[model samples]
Target: MNTGRDEDALRWDGDDDPTLDVGTRTAGADPTPDASGHDAASGEDAPPLALPDGFTAVGKDSDTVGHIEADGTVVMPGDKAPLSSPMLITLGILAGVYLLFTIGWIVGGLRLQGTAQFLVSPVGYQVALWLAVAAPALWFVTAYALTRSSKSWVRIVWLLAGLVVLVPWPFIMVGAVGTVAR
Candidate 1:
């Protein structure tokens, strides 16, 4: 009469332990009503509960609250909010500007290679040219890193300042893209 399936084998030996039953109350423990006559387990129209340690209430009338971890750290709404659409578009435009600046530096530096060699050694000119080419990318990355914890407007300001300061002057004045011919 034994089938291949063993029902006892499907469960652990401790499955019958009363302590493993989370929903049932212990033998002698009574549910006590707190102030306003609401039992803790019932959760019915409970008064505003006290937030655990390190949790901060946010918004008008505290309608919405942040997640409180067991270790007492709070995860705020803004902490994990993704970039807004306008902010994302602005970042994309700035990134394109930086890329264009890098290209400008390359084009301008190569165009001036022959002229620069007379004033500085070829090795020195090459090093300086490469540094100039890297300036836009370096400024963009450094600004982003330094302003990570600041407001979006602050980051935009820093990036805009870098754009003005790191313009490829030679490219605007003498490169093939410039109005002036060699």
Candidate 2:
């Protein structure tokens, strides 16, 4: 072991290294047999790869660490992990609500075609109508993606607020019932 080095320089204390050659053999010296009667210098008998000083081999079975799912999903340490059951249910409900909003938009847009004339052009009205319908779904997806690391309550509050705020106005007004003649 080289000594009298700078304090800041990186050093490896191999004196206590279990992987170090146990015999008093010099580097580049001819290989010798170990106490177990196996050739010490031979790669076949040695632990798969040399471990750092003071570390013991955990064996090949220990390689499969962390959370591994049967579906081939591997969740490493510090990973985001999968959503909980309640969260999954909430997301499903939100998707259903968004689908309903889209249906409502289509129904209302068709029903109001003759009654409510587009201030701009027919194409503009269609674009606006479709965009309005898609907005809630887009918002939900965006919010879900953005708030992935946030608390469950925070995500729920944000999505619920969006649900209330992004209600399709045309659907509420005209709807599938069509114009009411009073």
Candidate 3:
């Protein structure tokens, strides 16, 4: 009996909360404005949602798939979509292979050039030929790498810009030294 009496007293104290209302009892049931739970924002009276009344939904082409109201942004036909993973990977692999091949060629040419005259079987002409051919091709390969590396395009661009500064700087110094020698 005493336990039940204490529980009743606590419940009695809760009745005086001025902020409590009927809306709080069934807040999430629905938005029906009626005698039981009426809403002031009736159909015609409520602010209109910003959706357009009529529009068309388009897929990758002129073909229409569905209707859209003012609500949605549409993707027009033939938009340059993101490249697929296979394409990106293929390009990256090609870039890597080309880079490796160019590096090998440069190194090989240097080795051949250095040992050409001293070796028992003379290789000067062959080495010089390879160095001349590979050295110019390396520039083309580097240009291709810069173009193909979409993932690192920004980095490649900055690297190339730096290379522009570096490649000519040494030549300038070398030319100056030659002039001084003359």
Candidate 4:
């Protein structure tokens, strides 16, 4: 649709091609130059990130690397890759542990009103069960958080271990309060 009046080829307003600032609007056609003798507006092309193949560009055409599955599906995952079974398993374990502990507390409290089906110390039994589940879940969470951190694994391990050691103190204190009140 260009009239093709001038000598220099028209440049796109944007690198995306659709919003072109062609012809006289280009930096090449800028009348004023900076101290370096080149137009300051010429550095616009440096923002784009390079990408690999199989990821075909669609509308708006950003320079970001889009993910392309082997089945030819395009997914823009950004900084993260898809989770594997191990990762999903780890997440599931964490969720299960937290849920078990929370539900156990509620159920134990409800059963405290003279239920023959519940244990002598229903809350203790529930706590023990939840602790059993928490061990592996904590291991996975600590290892994951530590491994992903920039700090040394030793430091991360120590920090998480300290937190683990400290976590049960409040529960122990509550138990002591009950014993002392009796």
Candidate 5:
């Protein structure tokens, strides 16, 4: 019975190329010597890798790759930190609120369909209803995009403002059941 595990099937073209042997070195081992005859970890006064123009090295062992300006200032590019846990949670909550607002608008607008038809044409009512339904999402996206370059607090403030301004008033008053809440 053949196990159907052919070794030849797992091999790709250029599999024997030495240049493709990345991450194959053991821990604490020096990297292969470059064409300049210098080992990367040999502690010699030579850079490990040549960086392209306008590009700077970052991450582990990046201090050795720091670029020096003519004025003797060392320029090191740092990685942008990810969003904090609290900010992420806050954004998630805001997104949930916006989603709920959109659902509320949809339900509320549909509930008003009968009354709206009497005041406006069927097409006009439908267009208005859809616009209302999309208002929350549009506001959220716009605020997020516009405030991307601003501080986190500014974004939060804009989102909070939208929450206040885009309240589904029709839904709050008439509700999904279509009964006026005193």
Candidate 6:
């Protein structure tokens, strides 16, 4: 008899597939369709399978596990890790570094005001200065999100580069001595 399920249903990508039911075969019924005495055209009834003790049946509530879609993309389990604790710690530290850079801009911008006149008006300069200060954090977040499917090292490299390249120049120049006289 054609059960309507195709042969592809037998292929399991991973554990937790709903189709992977654990049960014994019914008596007088073969797993495969064949021309034996118990043929589909015979219309004979097969006995109910006796389940083992403590064996719970798989129900509709069961989660859909990993599977390869028609497009050939391997979809991972829903419970898979998005990011570990150590990776979170690294990201937290990077966030803190970005915060420190913002503080540096506030302090150094005040000091730099006395040393020179900005090419743009003071108001325009302030807007550009703050955007520059915020750029590193934005870069880190964007790179981390974009590289979710990529290797960890790729994300790490991009963040490290942002940390170095986005250093506040005004903060570094003023140093411990404060802003210099013209």
Per-model TM values vs. the true structure: 0.61, 0.55, 0.28, 0.29, 0.56, 0.52
Model 6: lDDT of residue 26 = 65
Scored against the true structure, residue 4 in model 5 reaches a CA lDDT of 56
Q: Which 10 consecutive residues of model 3 have the lowest summed lDDT?
A: 43-52
Clashes of each: 0, 0, 4, 2, 0, 0
- In the range 122-146, model 3's lDDT, one tens digit per residue, is 5656755455445434654665566
Off by over 4 Å in 4: 1-62, 77-80, 107-182
Q: Please tell me which model should have the higher TM-score, number 5 or number 6.
A: 5
Q: How accurate locally is residue 62 in candidate 2, as Cα lDDT from 0 to 100?
A: 40
In candidate 2, residue 13 scores what lDDT? 74
User: What digit string (tens of lDDT, one per residue) describes model 6 on residues 1-182?
Assistant: 98746955875557567677555566775554232224343355433222334434366523333444454454434534457678889878887887777777766766676554545677777777778767766887788899887777788788888788878777778854455677
Candidate 5 TM-score over all chains jointly = 0.56
**TM-score of model number 4:** 0.29
Query: Candidate 4 lDDT, tens digit per residue, 1-182?
Result: 77765633565335666556443445455544443335445533322233356445555535344566565555553445556677567556555654554444344433333542264575675566456446544655565676653434454455446445434332333333333543
TM-score between model 1 and native: 0.61
Per-residue lDDT for 77-164 in model 2, tens only?
3567788898899889988987887788777777776656645677877787778778878888888888988988888888888888
The residue-by-residue lDDT of candidate 1 on 51-86, one tens digit each, is: 665656776635334565575565544455457799
Residue 86 lDDT in model 2?
88
In model 4, the Cα lDDT at residue 100 comes to 50
Better of 3 and 5 by lDDT: 5
How far off is residue 133 in model 4, in Å? 16
lDDT per prediction? 0.80, 0.69, 0.46, 0.48, 0.77, 0.65
